[model samples]
Target: MYCVSCRNIHMFFPPFSHLTIVSLLFRCPWTVMANFKGHALPGSFFLIVGLWWSVKYPLKYFHRKGKSSQLTHYYQRLEITEAAIRTLFSVIGVLAEQFVPDGPHLHLSQESHWVKLMNWQHSTMYLFFAASGVADMLTYLSAHTPVGLDRLVMAVAVFNEGFLFYYHVHNRPPLDQHIHSLLLYAVFGGALSIALEVILRDNIVLELFRTSLAILQGTWFWQIGFVLFPPFGGPEWDQSDHNNIMFITMCFSWHYLAALCTVAISYSLVHCFLTRVKRHGEREIIGIQKLKSDHTYQTALLGGSDED
Candidate 1:
């Protein structure tokens, strides 16, 4: 659904050639509906979740380091709040997909069916995530909904997301397909790790791997936005250029490396900071006990009553 005007977005992606790039540059605004906002929104979500998990899983593993506990992973202590946030984001996605002026507004018929096929697809993806959130909420409140149902649902959602994206950008330009296909690596990797979480229960390795992939997803989404839309007022990529595609692939590798470094840094900081805090606390307690012992000895040596 490529259009010359700014109002209509083309696949939340754009530019197949130099001419097309120029057109998008002059026509599209900084916040193009084509997919910049879309990518950034979800990117921010993944980034936050990834960073949080990065800190949390490491902290949990360190805290439980010599303990004889069957579980040694981050637990969803704020399941209720987490579920609410997930549901809220999904709802926003669905509403934005269906209710914009150019949107079909939920109308699916012979005449209106082709209005925006991708929007419907996007809505369906969001629905699965929303279902996962609801499942988490139910698991938190209900006693008989089956253990690990929420995790299973979330794994399905992430899998479905990758499945959709795999089929979403086919027959498109080389650069377009290449850049988007890069996302499949993160999406599918995260999906598999999350599915593993369902089976492994509290395996910190699987959880950490999932969080690392999530960080990749977050950063890559923003990369896609810059490649496709270029919100910072620059020329768009040549969607048919092999050099551009190769560069993007290389750049994606860098993004993954950066994500890994970020995860490692997060773990190190949490471990170091918490370890120092714990050490200081133990020293404080020992100092207090020693003071009490010294006071008792002095009173006894001075011929004071034992009670004194």
Candidate 2:
């Protein structure tokens, strides 16, 4: 008979088992291995996209000589290449789901109800992935893009991620539940940021909050992999009642460090790219200066022409 508790233990405590090293390395099935891949894949997608968006505005602001509002008004305008990369990642995630053992299949009715529910849970994430991918592609194609649609799609994706994260937290063992719980809140915060952006229409702070949460989630995925599936045989924190406060604080600290590092790296790379493109740099600077000069000339003419 299959034992659910035994399966959960095996899933979380693979190293603690009394298996030979060779067996541990080779005998673990793909079903077991795919869990890490599942998290890591989406984690990478969010990390890259978040890193780009987090740096995009700051780079533009700097390029325009500290005139932040001189560029395009809306923030949803992303480079076509970057948007395509995000879409590609989402597509890959959707395709990757097909290979997972418990993932959704063509024949749903044949499966047990419990199996069906599990499959739905797994498939839901990728469905949202596909939705996000299409939305991004649409953004790339549209000349006159609507900010509301972009915000709505982002809101949907964030909400879906938040729901799945909460579900995982609820099912996690007590030892690991707190970390997942924090992650759930982070996801919600990202969703809230998106929602606020939808209402406020072009706020840098909201966009930063969303991107920050995405990076945090990406970093936490690696942390979960390390904590649950250690390199050697056994998890780092094996006991259910181990000291939780210190670890949680450490996780938060790691997130802060990761965010700072990601932003710095992204900013440096963006600045370098902008500097290398001579025509792009010259055109932006000239355009902003011309606009400023024209505004000044118009103001002087109006003041001089007016009869006091």
Candidate 3:
């Protein structure tokens, strides 16, 4: 039998334990989305871009038949088009924030400097997206593609993502912690992939990892929408039973399904391009032959073993 004083001491010490402290720092009260439109808009952008990248890379890889130096910039026209669309979306989002008087607009003219800063914080995510868009446009528009400029763009994206992660972690409620944490992981993973790409010059695996993270990010956006918004049982902010294991399992299962669907769509698109597009088909065939020849020559030089 434990003494009452000892029991009290144990309880007190447990609350101050490292695990408890970490949980307190990382966790917060559950929060519902007040500005659904703002989230959904950027969410859509990420989803579309992610789906495109995931599909584009695989098709490009097969088309080039593993001879390409850099799989990323192979489709120059598509890159430019994506950049233009991102820039357009960023501009529109910014403009809407500035002009839209009724909706979730930023309160930039608060009397208190602290309040003004907080207002800026609210819009930082969009601002970072806009900055990234501008950087992407500049990257594509440069007359002479300098390595430094490319690194700078990647660095800016990394910083933006880091900031976004912090914002979501602190500002979002505990109920949404899992979704936001997944997004943070995706952003951080993307940043790491970009850094690796910059260092390694061109790594196809790293590029694919980056695109996979993008797909995960997009999937999280839809999950957040479904969990926080209407038509799917409404927000979970006020609920105390958010730690349902079955619900969590379902959420992850949905993500896996979404990823598989994206891959299938990408493959189908690649097949269509190879079958219907005359120029692309011809180029791919030539590229494949060249790759085979190169492999054979390397194998012969290495005494019939291409391992080295």
Candidate 4:
């Protein structure tokens, strides 16, 4: 299926003028209600499972006792991902201009405002909260659950997996590389949401509340992701058979695709840096091994090739 982005970029998408007309015909109460139910059921299910895992298993894998070096390493990883997300959101907020309509109809395309920046920030922040919440739940479940229940975890792993699938299909990344992009996107999204709330003139609790609402609303993008490219081993159901296809097809997915793409680019840069460091370490190890082998060979030569 052609993406809204593909349509918009190619100038094939209908103008915003048709939105009202489409809203009356295609976005009626029945469709709206169906979409809501689609969102509500999966959302509530995830919430319940997340709460259960969080409460049932409170141990944090990120924390290490009596290992300052390990703690430092973990902190470094955290800081790197944090920076990646921030930069990702910043770039995304900047590029948001390109996707917006340039026609005389849309005001957002004309100029960047503090308010728009705040909204973009908030969107990222909310995405972060949701992703962190998922990670928290996954970590807890991994710690507490039996190996046999991996199936269930895989079932719900749909949320993250769906995001990855969408990333590849939308961005056209290789399958092996898509996970890295998704992980970075997830981190950037979470950070952006927090940045939004913190940057705005809102209380901490109010900001969190707002971020939560955004998380809930934005998760529909995942559902839409699931619909657009149903993953391998997914439950038996056709995308067209789903009732909320319009919600999946329309502006919501397009907005998220941009956000995810923004996050992915930032992640790629940051991850490249991290990978280079890792490669340097590996190369050092290989150099040491080669030196040791050369020493052994020289010793054998000094002894006239072989004792025999």
TM-scores, one per candidate: 0.83, 0.68, 0.64, 0.24
In candidate 1, list every pair of residues with a backbone clash: 12-34
Query: lDDT: which candidate is best?
Result: 1
Better of 1 and 4 by lDDT: 1
Candidates arranged by lDDT, highest first = 1, 2, 3, 4
lDDT of 4 by residue, 1-308 (tens): 22133235336434545544443433244433333333343344434433322221111211222233545545545534543443453344334322333212223333453333323332343344344434434433455734323223332333343443344334332331332233344334433444443344323333333233333334543454344334332553333343433433454545445534433453355455555876898899999999999999999898985665
User: What ranges in model 3 sit over 4 Å off?
Assistant: 1-34, 66-74, 102-106, 113-119, 169-173, 231-238, 268-308
**Candidate 1 lDDT over residue span 1-308, tens digit each:** 23454333344445465567556554646336556766776787788878888987787788678472554222444656778888988888889878876676887655433656777787888899899999998987788888888889998999998899899898878888888888998988887787777778768888888888999988998888888878766886789888898899899999999988998999889989988998999999999999999998997888765447
Worst 10 residues of 1 by lDDT: 1-10
Which is the better candidate, 3 or 4, if ranked by lDDT? Answer: 3
Question: What is the per-residue lDDT of model 3 for residues 1-308, given as tens digits with 9 covering 90 to 100?
Answer: 22233345457676566555544432322212333554565667677777787777677767677465574564766766777787677677665544443333555654553332422443565566666666666666786666535535655665675665566546455555655565666677777777776676545576666666677666676666666554334434442356653475467667756765776677677767766776787899999999999999887889845555
- RMSD, one per candidate, in order: 5.4, 9.7, 15.8, 17.8
- Candidate 2 clashes between residue pairs 3 or more apart in a chain or in different chains: none
Q: What lDDT tens digits, residue by residue, belong to model 2 across residues 149-237?
A: 66778788879977876776565567667766767767888888888877886565676667778888777766665565453445456
What lDDT is obtained when candidate 4 is compared to the true structure?
A: 0.40
Give candidate 2's TM-score.
0.68
- Residue 291 lDDT in model 2? 100
